[model samples]
Target: MDDDALRAWSVSVRYPGQPEPALADVSLSIGPQALTVALGPSGCGKTTLLNVLAGFVPPSQGRVTLAGAPITGPGADRAVVFQHDALLPWLDVRDNVAFALELQGVGRRERHARAEALLAEVGLAHAARQPVWTLSGGMRQRVGIARALASPSRALLMDEPFGALDAFTREQMQTLLLEVWRHSGRRIFLITHDIEEALFLATELVLMSPGPGRIVERIEPGFSRRWLAGEPVRALKSDPAFIALREHLLDTLARHRQANDKETA
Candidate 1:
Protein backbone atom coordinates (compact mmCIF):
# COMPACT_ATOMS: atom_id res chain seq x y z
CA MET A 1 0.00 0.00 0.00
CA ASP A 2 1.23 3.50 -0.82
CA ASP A 3 1.54 5.41 2.46
CA ASP A 4 2.68 8.57 0.75
CA ALA A 5 -0.59 10.10 1.83
CA LEU A 6 -0.26 9.05 5.47
CA ARG A 7 -0.02 12.39 7.22
CA ALA A 8 -1.16 14.86 9.90
CA TRP A 9 -3.08 17.83 8.58
CA SER A 10 -4.08 21.23 9.92
CA VAL A 11 -4.11 19.66 13.38
CA SER A 12 -4.68 22.26 16.08
CA VAL A 13 -5.28 21.83 19.80
CA ARG A 14 -6.06 24.44 22.45
CA TYR A 15 -6.69 23.77 26.09
CA PRO A 16 -9.18 25.89 28.09
CA GLY A 17 -7.84 29.44 28.65
CA GLN A 18 -4.33 28.42 27.62
CA PRO A 19 -3.81 31.83 25.92
CA GLU A 20 -2.84 29.97 22.74
CA PRO A 21 -3.28 26.63 21.13
CA ALA A 22 -0.96 23.93 22.40
CA LEU A 23 -0.69 22.93 18.77
CA ALA A 24 -1.32 25.09 15.73
CA ASP A 25 -2.41 24.09 12.26
CA VAL A 26 0.34 21.49 12.02
CA SER A 27 0.59 19.03 9.17
CA LEU A 28 3.06 16.35 8.03
CA SER A 29 3.05 12.98 6.21
CA ILE A 30 4.47 9.49 6.81
CA GLY A 31 5.30 7.13 3.99
CA PRO A 32 4.24 3.52 4.46
CA GLN A 33 6.68 1.44 6.49
CA ALA A 34 8.85 4.51 6.65
CA LEU A 35 9.74 5.86 10.06
CA THR A 36 9.04 9.58 10.64
CA VAL A 37 10.30 11.47 13.69
CA ALA A 38 9.21 14.88 14.96
CA LEU A 39 12.13 16.78 16.49
CA GLY A 40 11.59 19.88 18.55
CA PRO A 41 12.21 21.73 21.82
CA SER A 42 10.36 20.75 24.98
CA GLY A 43 6.67 21.76 25.15
CA CYS A 44 6.68 22.14 21.39
CA GLY A 45 3.57 20.00 21.02
CA LYS A 46 5.64 16.99 20.05
CA THR A 47 3.68 14.79 22.41
CA THR A 48 0.41 16.64 21.87
CA LEU A 49 0.63 16.01 18.14
CA LEU A 50 1.34 12.35 18.78
CA ASN A 51 -1.61 12.23 21.15
CA VAL A 52 -3.91 13.55 18.42
CA LEU A 53 -2.80 10.85 16.06
CA ALA A 54 -3.27 8.22 18.77
CA GLY A 55 -6.81 9.55 19.47
CA PHE A 56 -6.01 10.21 23.14
CA VAL A 57 -6.88 13.90 22.65
CA PRO A 58 -9.07 15.52 20.12
CA PRO A 59 -7.83 18.26 17.84
CA SER A 60 -9.65 21.56 18.11
CA GLN A 61 -9.68 21.99 14.37
CA GLY A 62 -8.89 19.99 11.19
CA ARG A 63 -8.62 16.23 11.01
CA VAL A 64 -6.15 13.30 11.11
CA THR A 65 -6.50 10.78 8.33
CA LEU A 66 -4.76 7.58 7.24
CA ALA A 67 -4.91 6.89 3.54
CA GLY A 68 -8.20 8.59 2.65
CA ALA A 69 -10.16 7.56 5.73
CA PRO A 70 -10.62 9.77 8.82
CA ILE A 71 -9.61 8.42 12.22
CA THR A 72 -12.29 9.05 14.82
CA GLY A 73 -11.17 6.88 17.74
CA PRO A 74 -8.38 4.54 18.70
CA GLY A 75 -8.50 1.34 16.73
CA ALA A 76 -6.61 -1.93 16.67
CA ASP A 77 -4.82 -0.71 13.54
CA ARG A 78 -2.89 1.97 15.48
CA ALA A 79 -0.83 1.09 18.55
CA VAL A 80 1.05 3.59 20.73
CA VAL A 81 4.14 3.47 22.98
CA PHE A 82 4.55 6.34 25.40
CA GLN A 83 7.76 7.52 27.09
CA HIS A 84 6.81 5.72 30.27
CA ASP A 85 6.44 1.97 29.83
CA ALA A 86 2.87 2.40 31.20
CA LEU A 87 2.76 -1.35 31.79
CA LEU A 88 0.47 -2.89 34.35
CA PRO A 89 2.40 -3.38 37.61
CA TRP A 90 0.44 -6.49 38.44
CA LEU A 91 1.23 -8.28 35.19
CA ASP A 92 4.50 -9.92 34.21
CA VAL A 93 6.15 -8.83 30.96
CA ARG A 94 4.60 -11.59 28.88
CA ASP A 95 1.17 -11.14 30.37
CA ASN A 96 1.38 -7.41 29.70
CA VAL A 97 2.15 -8.11 26.09
CA ALA A 98 -0.75 -10.54 25.99
CA PHE A 99 -3.14 -8.12 27.68
CA ALA A 100 -4.04 -6.27 24.48
CA LEU A 101 -4.86 -9.54 22.82
CA GLU A 102 -6.83 -10.71 25.81
CA LEU A 103 -9.09 -7.66 25.42
CA GLN A 104 -9.92 -8.88 21.94
CA GLY A 105 -10.81 -12.20 23.55
CA VAL A 106 -7.83 -14.08 22.12
CA GLY A 107 -7.36 -17.23 24.18
CA ARG A 108 -4.51 -17.49 26.67
CA ARG A 109 -2.32 -20.10 24.90
CA GLU A 110 -2.06 -18.25 21.58
CA ARG A 111 -1.55 -14.78 23.04
CA HIS A 112 1.21 -16.07 25.31
CA ALA A 113 2.94 -17.66 22.32
CA ARG A 114 2.78 -14.43 20.30
CA ALA A 115 3.83 -12.33 23.26
CA GLU A 116 6.90 -14.51 23.74
CA ALA A 117 7.97 -13.89 20.14
CA LEU A 118 7.62 -10.10 20.55
CA LEU A 119 9.48 -10.15 23.88
CA ALA A 120 12.34 -11.98 22.19
CA GLU A 121 12.31 -9.42 19.40
CA VAL A 122 12.91 -6.66 21.95
CA GLY A 123 15.50 -8.80 23.84
CA LEU A 124 13.23 -9.17 26.86
CA ALA A 125 12.37 -12.87 26.59
CA HIS A 126 14.63 -13.65 29.55
CA ALA A 127 12.72 -11.14 31.63
CA ALA A 128 9.31 -12.14 30.35
CA ARG A 129 8.25 -13.63 33.65
CA GLN A 130 9.37 -10.63 35.69
CA PRO A 131 6.89 -8.13 37.10
CA VAL A 132 6.93 -4.68 35.48
CA TRP A 133 8.00 -2.82 38.63
CA THR A 134 10.89 -5.23 39.18
CA LEU A 135 12.42 -4.49 35.78
CA SER A 136 14.97 -1.75 35.18
CA GLY A 137 13.97 1.48 33.42
CA GLY A 138 15.18 0.20 30.07
CA MET A 139 13.50 -3.16 30.51
CA ARG A 140 10.11 -1.56 31.02
CA GLN A 141 10.39 0.38 27.75
CA ARG A 142 11.31 -2.81 25.94
CA VAL A 143 8.20 -4.48 27.28
CA GLY A 144 6.21 -1.46 26.11
CA ILE A 145 7.51 -1.91 22.59
CA ALA A 146 6.90 -5.66 22.78
CA ARG A 147 3.29 -5.08 23.74
CA ALA A 148 2.81 -2.62 20.88
CA LEU A 149 4.28 -5.11 18.43
CA ALA A 150 1.96 -7.87 19.62
CA SER A 151 -0.95 -5.81 18.34
CA PRO A 152 -1.89 -6.05 14.64
CA SER A 153 -1.45 -2.31 14.18
CA ARG A 154 -0.44 -0.98 10.78
CA ALA A 155 1.14 2.08 12.41
CA LEU A 156 3.17 2.71 15.57
CA LEU A 157 3.06 6.02 17.44
CA MET A 158 5.90 6.53 19.92
CA ASP A 159 6.25 9.61 22.13
CA GLU A 160 9.82 9.93 23.39
CA PRO A 161 9.74 6.21 23.99
CA PHE A 162 13.28 6.04 25.40
CA GLY A 163 13.71 9.49 26.89
CA ALA A 164 13.84 8.10 30.42
CA LEU A 165 16.59 5.49 29.85
CA ASP A 166 20.17 5.97 30.95
CA ALA A 167 22.76 6.80 28.27
CA PHE A 168 23.95 3.23 27.77
CA THR A 169 20.51 1.68 27.94
CA ARG A 170 19.15 4.35 25.61
CA GLU A 171 21.68 3.45 22.95
CA GLN A 172 20.84 -0.22 23.25
CA MET A 173 17.14 0.56 23.03
CA GLN A 174 17.72 2.64 19.90
CA THR A 175 19.46 -0.29 18.22
CA LEU A 176 16.68 -2.66 19.23
CA LEU A 177 14.02 -0.28 17.89
CA LEU A 178 15.74 -0.01 14.50
CA GLU A 179 15.97 -3.77 14.23
CA VAL A 180 12.31 -4.13 15.13
CA TRP A 181 11.27 -1.44 12.62
CA ARG A 182 13.31 -3.10 9.93
CA HIS A 183 11.47 -6.34 10.48
CA SER A 184 8.01 -4.87 11.05
CA GLY A 185 8.17 -2.11 8.39
CA ARG A 186 5.11 -0.54 9.96
CA ARG A 187 4.63 3.20 9.51
CA ILE A 188 5.88 5.05 12.61
CA PHE A 189 5.19 8.49 14.10
CA LEU A 190 7.77 9.12 16.80
CA ILE A 191 8.13 12.31 18.87
CA THR A 192 11.43 13.25 20.48
CA HIS A 193 13.35 16.26 21.82
CA ASP A 194 16.78 14.74 21.08
CA ILE A 195 18.05 15.82 17.67
CA GLU A 196 20.50 12.92 17.34
CA GLU A 197 17.79 10.44 18.27
CA ALA A 198 15.47 11.93 15.67
CA LEU A 199 18.15 12.01 12.94
CA PHE A 200 19.45 8.56 13.78
CA LEU A 201 16.17 6.61 13.61
CA ALA A 202 13.93 8.64 11.38
CA THR A 203 13.78 8.30 7.60
CA GLU A 204 12.36 11.84 7.73
CA LEU A 205 12.87 14.51 10.41
CA VAL A 206 10.27 17.12 11.37
CA LEU A 207 11.06 20.15 13.50
CA MET A 208 8.36 21.92 15.51
CA SER A 209 8.27 25.15 17.47
CA PRO A 210 6.55 25.76 20.84
CA GLY A 211 2.86 26.36 21.44
CA PRO A 212 0.80 26.97 19.48
CA GLY A 213 3.07 24.42 17.89
CA ARG A 214 3.55 24.09 14.16
CA ILE A 215 5.99 22.08 12.06
CA VAL A 216 8.76 24.42 11.01
CA GLU A 217 10.71 22.03 8.83
CA ARG A 218 11.03 18.45 7.59
CA ILE A 219 14.24 16.93 6.20
CA GLU A 220 15.30 13.42 5.28
CA PRO A 221 18.46 12.43 7.18
CA GLY A 222 19.65 10.73 3.97
CA PHE A 223 21.79 8.09 5.67
CA SER A 224 21.59 4.34 5.85
CA ARG A 225 20.96 2.26 8.99
CA ARG A 226 24.18 0.32 8.45
CA TRP A 227 26.43 3.43 8.48
CA LEU A 228 24.53 5.95 10.66
CA ALA A 229 23.48 3.80 13.54
CA GLY A 230 24.36 2.69 17.07
CA GLU A 231 27.90 3.77 17.91
CA PRO A 232 28.39 5.66 14.66
CA VAL A 233 25.62 8.11 15.53
CA ARG A 234 27.08 8.55 18.99
CA ALA A 235 30.42 9.26 17.34
CA LEU A 236 28.74 11.89 15.16
CA LYS A 237 26.68 13.17 18.03
CA SER A 238 28.01 16.70 17.53
CA ASP A 239 28.60 16.54 13.78
CA PRO A 240 27.86 19.68 11.77
CA ALA A 241 24.65 18.33 10.25
CA PHE A 242 23.35 17.42 13.65
CA ILE A 243 24.54 20.75 15.00
CA ALA A 244 22.85 22.60 12.18
CA LEU A 245 19.56 20.84 12.81
CA ARG A 246 19.80 21.57 16.50
CA GLU A 247 20.54 25.21 15.96
CA HIS A 248 17.71 25.54 13.48
CA LEU A 249 15.21 24.19 15.99
CA LEU A 250 16.65 26.28 18.79
CA ASP A 251 16.34 29.38 16.64
CA THR A 252 12.70 28.70 15.92
CA LEU A 253 12.01 28.11 19.57
CA ALA A 254 13.78 31.33 20.46
CA ARG A 255 11.73 33.24 17.95
CA HIS A 256 8.54 31.85 19.47
CA ARG A 257 9.70 32.91 22.90
CA GLN A 258 10.56 36.36 21.63
CA ALA A 259 7.15 36.72 20.08
CA ASN A 260 5.53 35.68 23.31
CA ASP A 261 7.70 38.14 25.21
CA LYS A 262 6.69 40.95 22.89
CA GLU A 263 3.03 40.02 23.35
CA THR A 264 3.47 40.35 27.10
CA ALA A 265 5.56 43.53 26.86
Candidate 2:
Protein backbone atom coordinates (compact mmCIF):
# COMPACT_ATOMS: atom_id res chain seq x y z
CA MET A 1 0.00 0.00 0.00
CA ASP A 2 1.69 3.14 -1.15
CA ASP A 3 1.01 6.56 0.34
CA ASP A 4 -0.70 9.40 -1.55
CA ALA A 5 -3.66 7.33 -2.62
CA LEU A 6 -6.45 9.71 -1.47
CA ARG A 7 -5.78 12.87 0.48
CA ALA A 8 -8.28 15.58 1.47
CA TRP A 9 -6.45 18.68 2.53
CA SER A 10 -8.37 20.96 4.90
CA VAL A 11 -11.55 20.27 2.99
CA SER A 12 -14.74 22.19 3.76
CA VAL A 13 -18.13 22.44 2.03
CA ARG A 14 -21.15 24.73 2.37
CA TYR A 15 -24.34 24.23 0.44
CA PRO A 16 -25.57 27.34 -1.37
CA GLY A 17 -27.71 29.52 0.95
CA GLN A 18 -26.79 27.35 3.97
CA PRO A 19 -25.51 29.06 7.08
CA GLU A 20 -23.08 26.37 8.15
CA PRO A 21 -20.69 24.12 6.32
CA ALA A 22 -21.56 20.46 5.98
CA LEU A 23 -17.95 19.69 6.67
CA ALA A 24 -15.28 22.00 8.04
CA ASP A 25 -11.53 21.55 8.00
CA VAL A 26 -11.53 17.77 7.63
CA SER A 27 -8.14 16.41 6.58
CA LEU A 28 -6.92 12.87 6.08
CA SER A 29 -5.35 10.54 3.54
CA ILE A 30 -6.25 6.99 2.56
CA GLY A 31 -3.51 4.76 1.25
CA PRO A 32 -3.86 2.29 -1.59
CA GLN A 33 -5.24 -1.16 -0.73
CA ALA A 34 -6.84 -0.37 2.61
CA LEU A 35 -10.43 -0.43 3.90
CA THR A 36 -11.31 2.79 5.70
CA VAL A 37 -14.61 3.44 7.51
CA ALA A 38 -16.22 6.72 8.44
CA LEU A 39 -18.70 6.45 11.34
CA GLY A 40 -21.06 9.06 12.71
CA PRO A 41 -24.68 9.81 13.58
CA SER A 42 -27.33 11.23 11.26
CA GLY A 43 -26.53 14.59 9.67
CA CYS A 44 -22.99 14.31 10.99
CA GLY A 45 -21.52 14.88 7.53
CA LYS A 46 -20.49 11.24 7.24
CA THR A 47 -21.95 10.88 3.77
CA THR A 48 -20.92 14.41 2.86
CA LEU A 49 -17.29 13.53 3.53
CA LEU A 50 -17.65 10.47 1.29
CA ASN A 51 -19.21 12.67 -1.41
CA VAL A 52 -16.04 14.74 -1.29
CA LEU A 53 -13.89 11.65 -1.68
CA ALA A 54 -16.06 10.32 -4.49
CA GLY A 55 -15.76 13.75 -6.20
CA PHE A 56 -19.42 14.68 -5.97
CA VAL A 57 -19.96 18.00 -4.08
CA PRO A 58 -16.56 19.62 -4.26
CA PRO A 59 -15.33 21.31 -1.12
CA SER A 60 -15.52 25.08 -0.88
CA GLN A 61 -11.93 25.05 0.34
CA GLY A 62 -9.01 22.67 -0.25
CA ARG A 63 -8.99 19.66 -2.57
CA VAL A 64 -8.62 15.87 -2.81
CA THR A 65 -5.88 14.01 -4.65
CA LEU A 66 -5.11 10.51 -5.77
CA ALA A 67 -1.54 9.28 -6.23
CA GLY A 68 -0.29 12.86 -5.79
CA ALA A 69 -2.40 13.88 -8.77
CA PRO A 70 -5.34 16.18 -8.06
CA ILE A 71 -8.69 14.42 -8.33
CA THR A 72 -11.30 16.21 -10.43
CA GLY A 73 -14.87 15.06 -11.02
CA PRO A 74 -15.57 11.36 -11.09
CA GLY A 75 -13.27 8.89 -12.81
CA ALA A 76 -13.49 5.20 -13.67
CA ASP A 77 -10.63 4.61 -11.26
CA ARG A 78 -13.16 4.91 -8.41
CA ALA A 79 -16.26 2.71 -8.07
CA VAL A 80 -19.08 3.39 -5.60
CA VAL A 81 -21.50 0.91 -3.96
CA PHE A 82 -24.46 2.90 -2.73
CA GLN A 83 -27.02 1.48 -0.25
CA HIS A 84 -29.60 1.13 -2.98
CA ASP A 85 -29.17 -1.85 -5.29
CA ALA A 86 -29.72 0.55 -8.21
CA LEU A 87 -30.24 -2.48 -10.42
CA LEU A 88 -32.39 -2.07 -13.47
CA PRO A 89 -35.55 -4.16 -13.10
CA TRP A 90 -35.54 -5.06 -16.78
CA LEU A 91 -32.03 -6.48 -16.52
CA ASP A 92 -31.29 -9.94 -15.19
CA VAL A 93 -28.49 -10.40 -12.64
CA ARG A 94 -25.89 -11.06 -15.33
CA ASP A 95 -27.15 -8.26 -17.52
CA ASN A 96 -27.15 -5.87 -14.58
CA VAL A 97 -23.57 -6.71 -13.82
CA ALA A 98 -22.64 -6.39 -17.49
CA PHE A 99 -24.56 -3.16 -18.03
CA ALA A 100 -21.52 -0.95 -17.60
CA LEU A 101 -19.48 -2.93 -20.11
CA GLU A 102 -22.39 -2.88 -22.54
CA LEU A 103 -22.55 0.89 -22.19
CA GLN A 104 -18.96 1.00 -23.43
CA GLY A 105 -20.10 -0.92 -26.56
CA VAL A 106 -18.45 -4.16 -25.57
CA GLY A 107 -19.67 -7.23 -27.41
CA ARG A 108 -22.51 -9.04 -25.66
CA ARG A 109 -20.55 -12.28 -25.51
CA GLU A 110 -17.54 -10.80 -23.70
CA ARG A 111 -19.67 -8.72 -21.40
CA HIS A 112 -21.89 -11.61 -20.43
CA ALA A 113 -18.83 -13.76 -19.74
CA ARG A 114 -17.37 -11.12 -17.46
CA ALA A 115 -20.70 -10.64 -15.72
CA GLU A 116 -21.10 -14.37 -15.06
CA ALA A 117 -17.64 -14.53 -13.53
CA LEU A 118 -18.42 -11.66 -11.14
CA LEU A 119 -21.81 -13.17 -10.24
CA ALA A 120 -20.08 -16.43 -9.44
CA GLU A 121 -17.59 -14.59 -7.27
CA VAL A 122 -20.46 -13.19 -5.25
CA GLY A 123 -22.23 -16.60 -5.01
CA LEU A 124 -24.95 -15.49 -7.40
CA ALA A 125 -24.00 -17.88 -10.21
CA HIS A 126 -27.26 -19.79 -9.93
CA ALA A 127 -29.17 -16.56 -9.89
CA ALA A 128 -27.52 -15.17 -13.00
CA ARG A 129 -30.74 -15.48 -14.96
CA GLN A 130 -33.04 -14.44 -12.08
CA PRO A 131 -35.04 -11.28 -12.31
CA VAL A 132 -33.90 -8.61 -9.88
CA TRP A 133 -37.50 -8.31 -8.67
CA THR A 134 -37.32 -11.89 -7.43
CA LEU A 135 -34.11 -11.55 -5.46
CA SER A 136 -34.00 -10.69 -1.74
CA GLY A 137 -32.65 -7.47 -0.29
CA GLY A 138 -29.29 -9.02 0.55
CA MET A 139 -29.08 -10.65 -2.87
CA ARG A 140 -29.65 -7.33 -4.62
CA GLN A 141 -26.93 -5.69 -2.56
CA ARG A 142 -24.57 -8.50 -3.45
CA VAL A 143 -25.35 -7.71 -7.05
CA GLY A 144 -24.37 -4.13 -6.39
CA ILE A 145 -21.13 -5.40 -4.88
CA ALA A 146 -20.53 -7.60 -7.90
CA ARG A 147 -21.19 -4.71 -10.22
CA ALA A 148 -18.64 -2.57 -8.40
CA LEU A 149 -16.16 -5.43 -8.44
CA ALA A 150 -16.79 -5.95 -12.13
CA SER A 151 -15.13 -2.63 -12.81
CA PRO A 152 -11.34 -2.39 -12.75
CA SER A 153 -11.33 0.45 -10.31
CA ARG A 154 -8.41 1.47 -8.13
CA ALA A 155 -10.69 2.36 -5.20
CA LEU A 156 -14.15 1.45 -3.87
CA LEU A 157 -16.42 3.88 -2.03
CA MET A 158 -19.42 2.53 -0.19
CA ASP A 159 -22.11 4.58 1.59
CA GLU A 160 -23.81 2.45 4.23
CA PRO A 161 -24.31 -0.26 1.66
CA PHE A 162 -25.73 -2.65 4.24
CA GLY A 163 -27.76 -0.15 6.23
CA ALA A 164 -31.11 -1.38 5.00
CA LEU A 165 -30.67 -5.08 5.63
CA ASP A 166 -32.23 -7.03 8.49
CA ALA A 167 -29.83 -7.81 11.31
CA PHE A 168 -29.07 -11.31 10.07
CA THR A 169 -28.72 -10.16 6.47
CA ARG A 170 -26.62 -7.25 7.55
CA GLU A 171 -24.20 -9.54 9.34
CA GLN A 172 -24.02 -11.82 6.33
CA MET A 173 -23.35 -8.88 4.02
CA GLN A 174 -20.62 -7.70 6.38
CA THR A 175 -18.85 -11.03 6.13
CA LEU A 176 -19.20 -11.10 2.38
CA LEU A 177 -17.75 -7.62 2.24
CA LEU A 178 -14.78 -8.71 4.33
CA GLU A 179 -14.11 -11.60 1.98
CA VAL A 180 -14.33 -9.43 -1.11
CA TRP A 181 -12.20 -6.77 0.55
CA ARG A 182 -9.56 -9.32 1.57
CA HIS A 183 -9.39 -10.68 -1.96
CA SER A 184 -9.53 -7.38 -3.89
CA GLY A 185 -7.19 -5.50 -1.57
CA ARG A 186 -8.26 -2.24 -3.16
CA ARG A 187 -8.66 0.93 -1.14
CA ILE A 188 -12.24 0.88 0.31
CA PHE A 189 -13.94 3.83 1.96
CA LEU A 190 -17.12 2.74 3.75
CA ILE A 191 -19.45 5.23 5.38
CA THR A 192 -21.57 3.73 8.16
CA HIS A 193 -23.56 4.35 11.36
CA ASP A 194 -22.58 0.96 12.72
CA ILE A 195 -19.46 1.15 14.85
CA GLU A 196 -19.07 -2.63 15.08
CA GLU A 197 -19.29 -3.02 11.33
CA ALA A 198 -16.78 -0.25 10.86
CA LEU A 199 -14.33 -1.96 13.23
CA PHE A 200 -14.82 -5.32 11.57
CA LEU A 201 -14.18 -3.94 8.09
CA ALA A 202 -11.90 -0.94 8.30
CA THR A 203 -8.16 -1.10 8.78
CA GLU A 204 -8.58 2.50 9.98
CA LEU A 205 -11.61 4.21 11.52
CA VAL A 206 -12.52 7.85 10.96
CA LEU A 207 -14.97 9.14 13.60
CA MET A 208 -16.72 12.43 12.88
CA SER A 209 -18.63 14.91 15.02
CA PRO A 210 -22.31 15.90 14.65
CA GLY A 211 -23.51 18.30 11.94
CA PRO A 212 -20.91 20.68 10.52
CA GLY A 213 -18.49 17.84 11.09
CA ARG A 214 -14.81 17.65 11.81
CA ILE A 215 -12.57 14.71 12.66
CA VAL A 216 -13.34 13.82 16.25
CA GLU A 217 -11.05 10.81 16.42
CA ARG A 218 -9.01 8.33 14.46
CA ILE A 219 -8.15 4.79 15.65
CA GLU A 220 -7.32 1.42 14.23
CA PRO A 221 -8.89 -1.70 15.70
CA GLY A 222 -5.63 -3.43 14.69
CA PHE A 223 -7.43 -6.68 13.94
CA SER A 224 -4.76 -9.01 12.67
CA ARG A 225 -4.66 -9.99 9.03
CA ARG A 226 -4.96 -13.56 10.19
CA TRP A 227 -8.15 -12.76 12.11
CA LEU A 228 -9.74 -10.97 9.19
CA ALA A 229 -8.73 -13.92 7.03
CA GLY A 230 -10.62 -16.34 9.26
CA GLU A 231 -14.30 -17.19 8.77
CA PRO A 232 -15.38 -16.58 12.35
CA VAL A 233 -16.31 -12.93 12.07
CA ARG A 234 -18.54 -13.57 15.07
CA ALA A 235 -15.49 -14.19 17.23
CA LEU A 236 -14.26 -10.69 16.54
CA LYS A 237 -17.75 -9.39 17.10
CA SER A 238 -17.97 -11.08 20.52
CA ASP A 239 -14.47 -10.28 21.64
CA PRO A 240 -14.28 -8.11 24.77
CA ALA A 241 -11.92 -5.73 23.08
CA PHE A 242 -14.42 -5.22 20.28
CA ILE A 243 -17.24 -4.63 22.76
CA ALA A 244 -15.17 -2.08 24.70
CA LEU A 245 -14.21 -0.29 21.53
CA ARG A 246 -17.85 -0.07 20.50
CA GLU A 247 -18.87 1.30 23.88
CA HIS A 248 -16.10 3.89 23.77
CA LEU A 249 -17.16 5.20 20.39
CA LEU A 250 -20.86 5.33 21.27
CA ASP A 251 -19.95 7.20 24.43
CA THR A 252 -17.84 9.61 22.45
CA LEU A 253 -20.80 10.40 20.21
CA ALA A 254 -23.05 10.91 23.24
CA ARG A 255 -20.57 13.32 24.81
CA HIS A 256 -20.37 15.29 21.59
CA ARG A 257 -24.14 15.63 21.54
CA GLN A 258 -24.31 16.73 25.17
CA ALA A 259 -21.59 19.31 24.71
CA ASN A 260 -23.08 20.66 21.51
CA ASP A 261 -26.51 20.99 23.12
CA LYS A 262 -25.07 22.90 26.07
CA GLU A 263 -23.11 25.21 23.81
CA THR A 264 -26.27 26.09 21.88
CA ALA A 265 -28.40 26.46 25.00
**Which is the leading candidate under lDDT?**
2
Q: Residue 104 in model 1: shift from native, Å?
A: 2.6
In model 2, pairs of residues that clash are: none
Give each model's clash number.
Answer: 0, 0
lDDT of 2: 0.85
Question: Given candidate 2, what's the lDDT at residue 134?
Answer: 97
TM-scores, one per candidate: 0.89, 0.95
- List per-candidate RMSD values in Å: 2.4, 1.6
State, as a TM-score between 0 and 1, how close model 2 is to the true structure. Answer: 0.95
Alpha-carbon runs more than 4 Å astray in model 1: 1-4, 224-231, 235-240
Global fold similarity of model 1 (TM-score): 0.89
